[model samples]
Target: MNSVRTIFQDGGIYIALYAYLALAMIVESIYDNEAFSRWTARAGMIVIVLLIGFRWNTGTDWMPYLRVFYTTDSSSDYDSVVFGIDQGYVLLNRIVFYFSDNYSVFLILDASIAVGAVYVFIEKSTRLPNMGVYLFYTSYAVTHFMGSNRRMLAIGFVCMGFLFLSKERRIWEGWPRWAVPFGIAATVHRTSLAGLAGLMVSRRAWPAWAVIIGLLACLGLGMAGLPFSGLEWLGGTLAQYTGISAIDKLVFYTSGEAELGTDVNVALQAALGVAKRSSVLVIFIAYMRFGNPSQYAQRLYNIYIIGCAVYFAMVGSPIFQIISTYYSIVEIVLIPIIFAEIPKLKVPYILYLLVVPLLLLLTALIPYLELYVPYRSIFSTF
Candidate 1:
């Protein structure tokens, strides 16, 4: 059937991306040259651009975003916040709308900005940029950006700031530096606040035992049937910025009307997924114990640990899980640094080179929360 063909064709591209990176890694291992690695990473960008930029109607929000593109006007006051959209995003959309009405243009532009930002962030920030790109394509790209249109753009800007702050770690050059990007991200999605919270807390040194105790407490609360309905205030506050009213938001969260709450089955799946992914944390730990990383890298590792702690503590709470995701973006830089430094490891590097790829490949085969599945696109369908 044509539907099967579409899934293969579209999904094949992702598989090919994994293959391409695997081949590149093998080559890098043989040659042991930086030039090959850099060029390969740059080449990978071209593939990503093609894969993400050309696709149509593949993401869950594609039609909704298309409708938004058609409906949004360039003539409106740019500074005035459109209840559902960020001011900066509104301005960008209006500017794009000025030139043409085709929704594809917006898609192309968005894909470019997001993909390009990740590329630059990885290339400039990490020694093994290729690994960063590979992890991004396999782990985060389509699932995060394609379906969720606006927030990913904001996250891109936040990523840009994150890279910069990784290099320079002061108020003049660090967290304060990310303020503007974080502000922009908040406008695009209220979830940006979670990222900001992670960044702020990441600077402090939280004891491992204390973090463990806190996690136990949260999990205990979940087991006790807390229902988490009390957190409806947060949703109500977020609704103030969106077109949706507070009463509707309350109903949705409290009544289980929205696909917002997680049952035990979902939580178990999430726990397994987290455990699989958190295996990468071992590499970070190895690096810290054996090799001396730059201060920025250490800071990032700290943030990653904090993120992991938060995730384990709140695994049962979907609201808190969102917060954990924002923090986990540290993996982009962390994974690569771990890989590049594997040579200095006291143990054999072969285990990681074999295991990571297999894990990512397996994950890619699974559907992405019903948001990105079967990989439908206008290019293939029409």
Candidate 2:
């Protein structure tokens, strides 16, 4: 009975999300009103932001974040209390703590930054902003937003960075513009440095054949159990830069207790998700091949390629699942942009409308590692 109730509660949240998506689509497609569409999108955004922001006693990181907030407030020792959180986040928490101990203040601000960033990106960057919002909830919610607050906030900046990077005339030349967002993202979450690196190296799309061959090579190496020294270096660098213990991280990863692992079953699921994400990549490439994509669209395509390369290369590492999930999310916004220019490709929109709901359903049913299960909140009890 408890399980059933939990399922229903989770179902309700999913329904709410899908309702927003459906309404946005209808307003855009049937009403043909961008103004009304934006209004509906804003309303929908509020519903979700409240649902997530005011959430209490739910999400994997909820209590942890609360503890950190309080610890940061009460503790005099900086290093001991700060833990592994970035200075930016810690400072934010301290500021919030200054006024009140209430966690909602922090929650509200965090959610606003995270969700607001994406909302701004969609409104500013995409013609079909509604689709980007739909894709965000369907593709990004479970793996990212449910529990992980700090990184989600960091990702908001990363999304903004993408917007900044997309508009650049010369990718390498516009440092000051792009650097602020990416730099903040990195300071908030060191993993975003990989995104910064991706931007630097992926100035143009690699040949499709090369991408394919590289992906296959990565899979082969992962399956063969060959070590990639680069990943080790990456782990070490991240650890050193972030002031976390590298040996402790390695032990935790190898302890068979990490959320991701080298287990065959985990690998298969990670690979399957990667395969699903590649479908979008393939579509983007196809459009690029057959259509006269704009310069900006082509640049996004190149970044997507780099995302794929990083994803595939991480397959053998314990962090593969995390990297895979991170890379999988870019397509939500990228695909809409790519197809926006090619109006004749009605199939992509059709597929998006049909496919996103399935992904949302999967997210609700699988429960996304069970972190999203038993969806309780401070405001309601199911």
- TM-scores of the models, in the given order? 0.79, 0.84
For candidate 1, write residues 117-224 as lDDT tens digits: 778778777777777777777666765766567766766766766765565455555455678777777766666666665455444334445644755675566555
- Stretches of candidate 2 off by over 4 Å are 1-10, 73-81, 171-174, 201-204, 225-265, 316-320, 324-328, 364-370
Q: What is the C-alpha lDDT of each candidate?
A: 0.63, 0.66
How many clashes does each candidate structure show, in the order listed? 0, 0
The numbered model that scores best in lDDT is: 2
Expressed as tens digits, the lDDT of each residue in 169-277 for candidate 2 is 6666777666888788776676766676545544455677887888778667666655445445555556545434445455445444466322235555556656765
Model 2: residue 216 alpha-carbon error in angstroms: 1.7
Quote the positional error of residue 348 for candidate 1 in Å: 5.9
